[model samples]
Target: MVAVRLSADSNGVLETPRDGDRMSAISRRALLTTTAGAAAGLAVAGCGAAGGGKQGAPRAQRTGEHSGASGARAPAKTVRLIGDGSTADTGPQPNQPVVDRLEPGQTPPQFVVFSWDGAGEVGNGLFPRFRKLADDHGATMTFNLSGLYLLPEDKKLMYAPPNGPLGASDIGYLSDEHIRMTLDNLRQAWTAGHEIATHFNGHFCAGSGSVSRWTPADWKSEIDQAVAFVTQWKTNTGWYDEEPLPFDYAKNLIGSRTPCLLGQDNLLPTAAAIGWRYDTSNPGGDQIWPSKRMGVWDYPLQLIPFPGHSFEVLSMDYNMLANQSHAATSSDPRNYPGWRSQATASYIAGFQRAYETNRAPFFIGNHFEEWNGGIYMDAVEETLKHIAAQGYKDVRMVSFQQLTDWLDAQDPALLDKLRTLEVGEQPPGGWKEFLGQVPASTATGGAGEGAAPAVTATT
Candidate 1:
């Protein structure tokens, strides 16, 4: 178990109530309270520390040794640098699953997305720990990188957050050493087939300067800055020794998860206008099939069954901690054993319900935190292994970008039919009969003369 340093709030207040100061910057609403009955209150999953520590010297260049998106190594090719050589064009991404349209009556693959927030590596080893885990299981996940993590704290004024003064930030900036480590992890993550999406910057979640109040124009500004920090790190930092990132950020970033799960209502328009493919910022969503908002796929944090409780909890590590110990990052030692088991069970139960019934994709969000003695991290590791044991043929662990590719390639009618199945509700009759009625022309890659059939299933 690792311990993370708590970042000061936007106002520079450091409230250290526990060993790690877990919620030092968490908003009031983020202090979620769940009860014993079926009336548990929903709380937002707050972002964790952006702390960094010594992790070893980062590799100076990309070897391109990792396999491609389809699990096959791409042919050796020269890398063409972009901009000031902060990033490069590395052909197709590696470790990506080949997206194919599901044949009629075929069982849809159970998709599980394990995503990380504030994807910073602060010497705690959480970042590389999970990357190794994914490698062991042949799984790929998304790392929602915060742009501020790359910007040196000394260059804080470079960022002009909307509704706030110059150099203002809620989450602390990583040290130069940590920043180098972050760059290294990002480079390796991309080449290993994991997505490097945005988690925005500043992490402002409270007061007038909070992201929740930001307008679409404000969101556009924030997104632009986030991209700049990533694509032009060389120009900003003046560091020429390190290698550029493997992929082009401008084209690679197709999705994001807003800070504190706030401002999505306004962020959606800017996301769609910018041609983003998906958004996972919505809160307290049911365990049902996802729909689109502003023409972009909406993959929200779902309400999964909370073990030993009447109500459910959000499919996130922070939410589990909130319910278990009232948001305390460190709690009574006696409760650790039971809490770990409960958290593990919660994730597994959620996955089983969807995999056995509706086949809805499972989205789990976490931070590189050691909250509650790092039990949440342990639970997440266990959950990943549990699902991986189900065999890769049917249970495919993927990134949000990979999942979106599959979704876009599918038959819309078939997807609509799948959406009809509610949480824990199986397909009417069976898989063979329920999907057998979909017309062939509407099937993926099918181009026939027959018209697509209307939805006859109960909504």
Candidate 2:
């Protein structure tokens, strides 16, 4: 039987499982303390100040992945310093002024809104419009395409027949025609610069119930197959060179939102072992929390509990919106136009509140197939526009893997700042703290256009 465990800390409630389980809980406080100690140690070592006399000036270079289209290498000037005088290392070089400053208790930098449940009965014929909406909002969404949708000929055969190794009914079965259409649609989206990741070949229910039931090898094959299919499609469509298939260019089929968000505890650790860096399956509902596992990040879909049945309420709204949009006419007042106006208003209001309060990256989660077509489409576009107007600049629309890469590339200084704050420290009851700190600007040597002086301190 699958076991689950929930724990609370300064960030929010975190659900993980027992040892040896797929998911693990991390204490924000513990993480901060650990990070702080490490930073302090590094600072002392770098300066050679711990032993007595000063050492040769430590190297000025910082290391991490660059944020660019070609994955080309670029120098990062800002580095995270730890210890008593870490901040002293940073100062305004000759001509430059610090434009942005981060104080203690600030929320972490950047917010992301990710969508799941793309492909299959719900997502078929709906993605084109959805893609448009995502584009309009300047938001990056991950379409966790179900693998069953990739098989065209014997679509039903993709699902494990009853009495097969995976006992329960297949949750994401789709018609062969629908599968091919969805594949084509996804290719279009990818070419247009959207992220397409995996939701799993069998969905969440596929590997639920017991670990003994599914081996590591089974899990690997399931994930590998999805990666292989997408990679092959890119090649077939001439997206990559035909002669020497760009295996390196293969998208890091890394993001996953479990079917039903059910088997997250089981899926997370398994994913990590197989090289995934992020999972968006947990349903914390509006609150953002870092994952316990260090390498992977958890972008939980925020769901707020209401007086009435919450899921039922959301489901009803989804269906209503879907139907209204699907049947909407250009002139219908209570149809597409009405839903767009209302949803946009709500999304803007919510986003503003989150931004002002420094609790952002607002997540609006829904199955691709659940809504009335026109209404859903309209809501998506309006929401996108509203967000853009709200001054959310440089929003990175990326896949789950890209998110992880971004996180991995975080300026050690940013992480150091979070570490110094002491993970679980909360501001006074009435005060709102901004935890999102922007990285220090990189330094360009030899005085080029917009170049600043190079200042290095030895203490």
lDDT winner: 1
**Top candidate when judged by TM-score against the true structure:** 1
The estimated TM-scores of all candidates read 0.84, 0.54
Over 1-459, each residue of candidate 2 has an lDDT whose tens digit, in order, gives: 111223433332234333344322212111100000111001000000000000121111111111121111212333232222101112111111112333343444445564645443222335555555554544445667655454433323434422245322234334444443454455334433445566655433223432224454555666775555444543223323211111122333666765435445656667777656677766444433343343456676553321212121121123223223321122254454556555555455545555544333455554443223345445555655666665755343344544444444444454443433321233234232333333453432111222223332211
lDDT of 1 by residue, 288-322 (tens): 77778777888988878887776677788877776
- For model 2, the stretches where C-alpha displacement exceeds 4 angstroms are 1-110, 120-125, 153-176, 204-218, 228-251, 292-294, 304-346, 370-377, 394-399, 412-459
Output the worst ten-in-a-row residue range by lDDT, candidate 2.
44-53
Q: Tell me, what's the RMSD of every candidate?
A: 8.8, 17.9
Clashes of each: 8, 21
